[model samples]
Target: MQQIAIAQAAEGMVLAKDVETGDNRILCGKGTALSAAIIERFRRMDISHITVEGHPVVEEGAKSLKEELLDVENRFSKVRHIKPLLYLKKRIQERLIASRRPQPAAKSEGS
Candidate 1:
């Protein structure tokens, strides 16, 4: 069986490695960042017969991932409507105080 290296692997490409019989395939398999997405797609396609090797290039790709995650967090915070609750509470308190106060009567023209 031939051993495939991750550096030579590309997304959407099938691995040329082979698994041995009675071996724990999942434990033996290591993957790269390119391989992770490809593996996911392969899983979705029900193609799980190939063996993979190498750790994901997560450290190498961390900057892009961090930026994407930050963007998602910012978008979620914006869509959560948290500020609207505070504004509504303040407006309600103001209205309640206004309702509790006594209004002054208008002066008569003759007086």
Candidate 2:
């Protein structure tokens, strides 16, 4: 599963997680297959992103995984020796990789 910006969401994609509004109203349940109408509704609600059960939608000009990992390492270099911070850095790195990994595309109507 991957979180993608609403602008990148396409029809027929299944949501991996529930989508909720700012005040905690559930807009859509998890596992819902998105459609053009649903997507438009989300846009109207000002939703920015949603977790989908498929490959991440890499934005144009996004950083490569290697570049991202290196940047994260560099950012945490100064506090590497700190035990608590080291753990935090490790968790951050894990999440970074997960977010960047490519998965199979969501099934479309044509499939």
Candidate 3:
């Protein structure tokens, strides 16, 4: 889940956690699929930010999984003939891919 500013909240994005007012009153529950009107309402209410499900926003210059893996392979190209180095490269690729995969959001105490 990603915590983002209200201006960044787009329609159809699911809420990862309950959005509350300053007094702790829930404005919207978790798992809500936001719409444009609802987002506007929140803005009017002065809600600054919210937590949304998944990592939807892609920052510029961010390398994709494939791109990163290729970079690792290129770095070890000269030593590919060495069996030990090849094994090391394979391990690095495996770890890289695993890291890029989505991780389950940790459960909060209140949930």
> In order, what lDDT does every prediction score?
0.40, 0.80, 0.79
Can you give the lDDT of residue 45 in candidate 1? Answer: 49
lDDT of 1 by residue, 10-88 (tens): 4533232433234534322222222455545545544445533222223444344345545545545544568876565
**Best model per lDDT:** 2
lDDT over C-alpha atoms for residue 65 of model 3 = 76
Candidate number that wins on lDDT, 1 or 3: 3
Candidate 2 residue runs with Cα over 4 Å from true position:
1-7, 20-25, 35-55, 102-111
Off by over 4 Å in 3: 60-111
- Give a tens-digit lDDT track for model 3, residues 1-111: 677899898877778889998999998888777878779989999999898876666657977778989999899989958999899999999887765454444433233
Q: Tell me which of candidates 2 and 3 scores higher on lDDT.
A: 2
For candidate 2, write residues 3-56 as lDDT tens digits: 889998987778888899999988888767788988999999999999987455
Error of 3 at 106 (Å): 20
lDDT of 1 at 48: 42
Segments in model 1 whose C-alpha atoms lie over 4 Å from true places: 1-81, 109-111
Residue 20 shift from truth in candidate 2, angstroms? 4.8
Q: Itemize residue pairs with steric clashes in candidate 2.
A: none
